[model samples]
Target: MAPASLLDLVAALPPSDGWGPSVATETTLDGVPYAPYSKADKLGRMADWTEGKDRERGGRQQYGNRNYRDQQVYGANQQNNPFGIIAAEEEATFSVVDNTRTTTRGRGFGRGGGTVFRGRGQRGAQNQRGGARGTFQRVGAGRGGQQQGYDNRGGRGGRGGRRFGYRDDKPQRNRDASIQVRPDWALLEEIEFTRLTKLSLDTPDGEDIDSYGFLYYYDRSYDKQPGAKTSEKRLNVLERAAYNVTTSSDPIIQDLADKDEGTIFATDTILSMLMCSPRSVYSWDLVLTKQGDRIFIDRREGSSLDMVTVNENAADAPLETSEGNKDTINSPSGLMMEATHINHLFPIQVVQESESAKRDMPNEHPFYNPAEETDPAASKAYRYRRFDLSLADSEEALHLIVRTELDAVVKNTISGEDQFLTIKALNEFDNKAQGSGGALDWRTKLASQRGAVVATEMKNNSFKLARWTTQAILAKADMMKLGFVSRVNPRSPNDHTILGVLGYKPREFAAQMNLNLANGWGIVRTIVDMVLKMDDGKFVLIKDPNKNMLRLYSVPNDTFEDEGSVMEKVEEDGDDE
Candidate 1:
């Protein structure tokens, strides 16, 4: 074999199968078909940097960079090559460790784990991260690397790392309901605020069916510049024969119901609460009774529904002691009682109860009686109005009868005629308290920065203001007087002083607060339709304490009866006092 010549060895190789691949009997190698190649074809650059720029300049191909195209030999196999060199097994086991010192800007445990740089203004915000322009995040540890708690590399590879939801650093709120939900009650429907806000209905201005009671002239002195020393008046407790008769119990409403005047009946207070339910943060409930086709909105005796809530819609609403509210006076229930007392006392004090100056309504006081009542009647007039809530597409008419109220009357300066007024009071608790909701010092700011003070109140007590406006609009009052009343002592709620009064057109105030009356009417109609579909039984519409939702429950008729009419008992006790 060693003596054989080089030509003999080459000739012994069984005649070369041509220069390249064999041309006969084979079109493919294994399963891959052989591709035609030309000898003149030139291999592109190994590291082409100019191809991308050239293509970008519109001089070459459009789809991708030509420089990065495949450059490997078509049929080359390095393992089987005759000139391939094999390294020692010991040398193959040797590894190179990167010991170079690299400084990581920032390290976080989330998807965007690298250093988070922010502008000067965003430095103090803990949750405000920069955009994902140059963020480098590592999601998990590399193979043989120690596992880390967080990695920035796990980001989805986009400018500004992606975040799923909003970052809310505030503590979660868990509030209690005004009325306890009985286990026996059945939940019928749960509606979200997002859906309720989308509803819209346009109803008439309403027709005055009947008017009762009388109204005294509103004292113009209280309307002086708010927070003025001269305008400050002590809030007087008025023992007036005030009545909050529910729809089914009210004789006027029952008569109207018997006559089929409306399919729904509610007082202005109850109706406003239902209309403004979506804006509420605190829990509240109203009882509804469906008898045949008619539904009545009622409030239980001593119900929280009759009370006004303070800072009910604030971001940091007043919490109960159990919910971590340290200040007892600023607690929701405490604030409600204080607000109710102020509202009750502020209205009567602002009116001049002179028989000579008083204006009489079409009918006498509906619930007040001189023979049966010991206390004098309050200067309030009840107007039973009917609004047509029937949809244009509906076959049947849907009417709502609301029993509205008027507190006082004012002489129109221009027309020299009497204008009806709806009186409400906004009280200030401790502004420095946790749940103050960034309220300004009403005593110091009400006169000079009245708009700022009112704006703060609107933000904090959106639900309360909206309800008052709704009531005023429902009553068709020419003016809605919001009296600023402050406690005589910030620590004590027993006595209060009226700072001043501001008058606003109901519609104008509604616009300022973004209160949509049509939307409110629509919500009412929707709830009414829902209740009408159910059996003729007592139902309750309750606002969820923590979430923006409302739940309708079918309850037994005797649910609240065990309470034994505490409102009347309390009123009787007050009368005795």
Candidate 2:
């Protein structure tokens, strides 16, 4: 082949024009600013659930659902919301002691009392919580950002202040572990939210109480290296097009909940769910065509369509060919891998890219290399999902967790016939005509109830979605119990795997089993079909049809093939080990 001529390239060039007519942001909304706050989250604040009903009395104030925990709060997620308040069996009372007699009996009675010295200079001194009475020591009258009388021994959590950095709000609850009462919410600075635009309450500049609820939300951004410049090509798992997915209960979440005391444990999964766009286009290449020098490239964009056409015709009309005269040939996806060039001009490049990469469950076990493996402390057996109190629509966030801790709490807290068969029964336990040994413990009730408001709402669709979430988690958990887990990424000697900007290190979240996109019906679909024998498929996942739930097991027909029976009792506790 001879080298292409410069004149040939010049003749193949297509026409170019400036951008089309402009449009302005004023296409819809008024120029005036709306109160940034949307009253959506507060819609259900007064709902019966908020009142710690059947449980101890606690504060209730609902906020916008989609907002960060600083704004997104509901009865279920809020630690301070009456439900989580574990009341002490004995209430404390304070009484002042008479000290005049003691003073009189002292030398003051016999000798004349001396006049007190000037004290205006030291007037700032005061007891922190209560007066130091009798022989007992009291909280000092002064301690910056410290709780007063509440006998809290735990370290100040989070930011250690009120919603507006106010440590001044009266401490609501606290006690040493011996007493077992939870610490004050006002002290858990981590849970507090400052105004989006303001740093301190001392300044009355930016947003107010209402506007604060509408602060920053998760935008599904890419995770670049600490100092690396932001590139459009980099994307986290949730932002990609090949079916991005993640279970809501990240380890980062559990750390926050562990520290939370009456403060809201946020449930931002729904909004994160919305972040995974199904029709999302990850990337595309620019097709540069050349015939002789008459190159033609279609610059027009149709957002919904996948391909762009490029023709090399120099004339306005298509070339008169025997087969047909057409100026169309759509660009194919993944063509970047294809090698077709005119004089080595590499202009057909990937132009658009997703901010995140899609992730799937691993097909095998031991998530990390020999040196890097499960954290040993992270919850691997049963995933914990914190479902939001408010509801929203989501197609990608089809993830679910078994609420292992909640199940344990329910089984231990409520025994025998009192056990709930349905979520409604558990939720309605508060309204029972006969109060069962006081209120049925609101914290227990909220946690016990599978408040999958959105996921469970579509009972039919959730079955399959739940199966994938369950089976994969179960498999990983079982592997973990056996001192191994799925390989999260390809293993190397140092346990390093290229994890984008975060680098080739251990993953922060639970290790997963990938279900690739190539699996005809999708990974989750394939898992469900095989597990449930759906569509008359082979039954690998046993169905415990006691309830409508399609619980999984290896043997479909065995009466004792439930996950608890087969997976745990037989496999985990086999006694061979």
In the range 430-494, model 1's lDDT, one tens digit per residue, is 88887889999988899999999999999999999999999999999999999988888888878
- lDDT for residue 144 in candidate 1, whole number 0-100: 33
Candidate 2 residue 195 Cα shift, in angstroms, is: 28
Tens digit of per-residue lDDT, candidate 2, span 1-577: 8987665565566644658643332234346344333344343333343234211322222222221233334444333453334656563342233344321111121233322211111111122112222112122222243322211221122224223324545342211111111222111011011111121111111111110000011112222332222322321122211111121233433343344311122111221111111211122111112222121111112211122111111112112222232311111111111111110111101111222421112211112233443332111112233322111343432221212210100111344221111000001111122211122332233234323321221131222222223322322221100000011221211111111111110111122222121221132222322323222211121111111112222212222225345566676666877
Question: Which model scores highest in TM-score?
Answer: 1
RMSD (CA, Å), each prediction: 13.2, 38.9
TM-score of 1: 0.71
Give the Cα error of residue 326 in candidate 1, in Å. 3.0
Rate residue 126 of model 2 by lDDT.
23
Please, what is the whole-model Cα lDDT of each candidate in the order they appear?
0.80, 0.21
Q: Please provide TM-scores, in order, for all candidate models, with all chains considered together.
A: 0.71, 0.13
Off by over 4 Å in 1: 1-169, 562-577
